[model samples]
Target: MSRTLINRLSHARRPLLALAIVAAALGTAHAGYNVWTGEYTFTKDELQSAVDKRFPATLRYGELVSVRLSNPRLVLDEAGNRITTRVDAALSNTVIPSPPVNGSLALNSGVRYDATRRAVLLDNPTVQDVEVQGMSQYREQLNAIGAVVAQQLLKDYPLYTFKPEELRFNGKDVEPGAITVAPDGIRVQVNLR
Candidate 1:
């Protein structure tokens, strides 16, 4: 092989080697580390089992037709040991009612479930009219639907009461629209209307 050609081949090989190293590093960071830490030991079935045990009769993953989470609060207890968590969650979906309705319906509502207190203390609900074959249902049915939605939301995302227990918070009763849980911590997002 010509000297110039050999040199060019060597330069190309260096980049190829660098690219291979980078790819291996990324793979290790994404998946290899999980294997070493035993984080990947929990299979989807195992996770679903745990979640189902914690939240029975609640929709899991794709079963959730709609969901809205709002108003989160995180606070330290008087003892400053555990963290208190509170949030209002709203959810809705279609299900085969006992005496199944021939048509579909819409439900909506909000609820405050406190993990510390292990209680559902606050519920705010509203429902919209659902027409079946051009015939509108009673407002009471709509309200019932809303209540069901709220109850389901509570069931699905039960308040993390354990946080307060762990933090040693006083765990006082919470009110509606008072606080909420955020991605980072308890944060209230103000809306100017």
Candidate 2:
């Protein structure tokens, strides 16, 4: 064995070990920093604007009458790992040969992500509560009225559509996997692919 070669090898081993340690530390930090987890929150006002745009201000059941929605309010809930939304609307109905009927409508709905449709859907909106002002004479018809209004209002509406280009991570679009309804707003959890 040559003494010079052995001495050179021994000196090189220290730097090699140091380089390996530095590489490991850098890898750990990169992994920690590169975790792409983010939530997109949709505020109440934003949802209201969307609803206003998607649905009409006045809907008619027949030629003789029409209902108008005003002062829309939203309440969000997280149930069974899904989103449940309730919309409270001030309703004003105008009927021919009658003045007008004013009331409040509480529309309860479940929100779900439809994989096949690639959209966020509001499913089966039902009237959780209905308040009719100055209509005590027709109390028995309140539920029926509310149900019809709800059905007509939210028949086939998609609250959100997944545009792969819109949801992005690191300048590349990502797909969202889950949505949660919170008190403050709706949160969409995006996955980085």
Candidate 3:
């Protein structure tokens, strides 16, 4: 009777173990579908390329001829939830046919998502500093000008725009609630709709 009972218990244990394994596998698969959060990283080179494609190579303001941007650099701060960009601007004028005024500008900006527009927007960008060659006396003017230029450039150009494909999971569209930047990368928080 003891031998018979041991055989019966071993037979039951095999099926129970199999059932537990199947349940674990199913749980893992289910977890993938419920992953509402994901991070996408962008290097400075990638962002610079995107900006180059969307941003105008040159902007004009009356006498400001061929105001060109060069050597674009991007810095992300996740802790502060801010992004800082450094760029060199070459300002030329028709009146002063000499060398262009070489200026470096640093723009610090916060991130915001526009649900209605379905795009990422830079919020309240301020000019951290502007240094123009041999123009220390006009530092304030340069800073203001740089801020205005940065705002104008960012107005229509979004850092990232969500396509129907990107914001969708299992064919359902979701919203990107927040955009945060870190030293390493940018993170988009997804909100399931």
Candidate 4:
């Protein structure tokens, strides 16, 4: 549910890489059959751009407290096979004349491929922590509200999508099959449809 980052990635990431080009016969070694497998790697910068579009969001709680979240910084967790995001937050409770509370939030999310959309999206995302500067008293409430808002804003958020040309190569219709979260980037293997 964010702006398309594939246009840029389509130019940088290679798809449908021929992994095994074994020759059928010794004489035809140079003309090996084409293996239509694809690998899509998403850089951190590309992922960040996808996370940035859904920002500057506002959600009100209990008709008094309102939370505004923005500037989501996404960190890839190859070990956990997920992404951790930190966002700047502002909380304002109309019950008092106090200024908005400033803080940050840490959220972790797994990635999955949506065939219908032909894109990789956030899966099972959760807000792990919330830190509000000078507003420890509201941390508990803010955390609760942050999770709700994050779910609303980030649920099914698309990280990357394959372009039409990238999906089709040598007369094969390919789709995303395997998803790997790695240190360098998120890699997706395209499977023939």
C-alpha lDDT score of every prediction, in listed order? 0.37, 0.62, 0.70, 0.75
Predicted structure 2, TM vs. truth: 0.62
Write the number of the candidate with greater lDDT, choosing between 2 and 3: 3
Model 2 is weakest, by summed lDDT over 10 consecutive residues, at 28-37
Per-residue C-alpha lDDT of model 2 across residues 1-193, encoded as one tens digit per residue:
6999999999999998998887676445433122334555567666666666644367665565566666566666655333333343444445535656677777777666676666666778787777768777766676776788777776546776765544554477566667777766577676665
Ten contiguous residues minimizing lDDT sum, candidate 3: 30-39
- Tens-digit lDDT track for model 4 on 1-193? 2236766565455442222223233214312122333466677888888888888788777788888888888888888998888988888877987889788888888899998897799998788888888768867776787788768877898987666666765577877777778876787876778
What's each prediction's TM-score?
Answer: 0.27, 0.62, 0.72, 0.76
Best by lDDT: 4
lDDT, candidate 3, at 41: 44
TM accuracy, model 3: 0.72
User: Could you tell me the lDDT of residue 124 within candidate 1?
Assistant: 45
- The regions of model 1 sitting more than 4 angstroms off are 1-99, 102-105, 111-122, 128-134, 137-159, 168-178, 181-193
Q: Which whole-number lDDT from 0 to 100 does residue 155 have in model 2?
A: 51
**Against the true structure, candidate 4 has what lDDT?**
0.75
Index of the highest-TM-score prediction = 4
For model 2, what is the alpha-carbon lDDT of residue 114? 70
Superposition error at 60 for model 2 (Å):
3.3
Q: Candidate 4: where is the Cα deviation over 4 Å? A: 1-37, 137-139
In angstroms, the error of model 2 at 147 is: 1.4
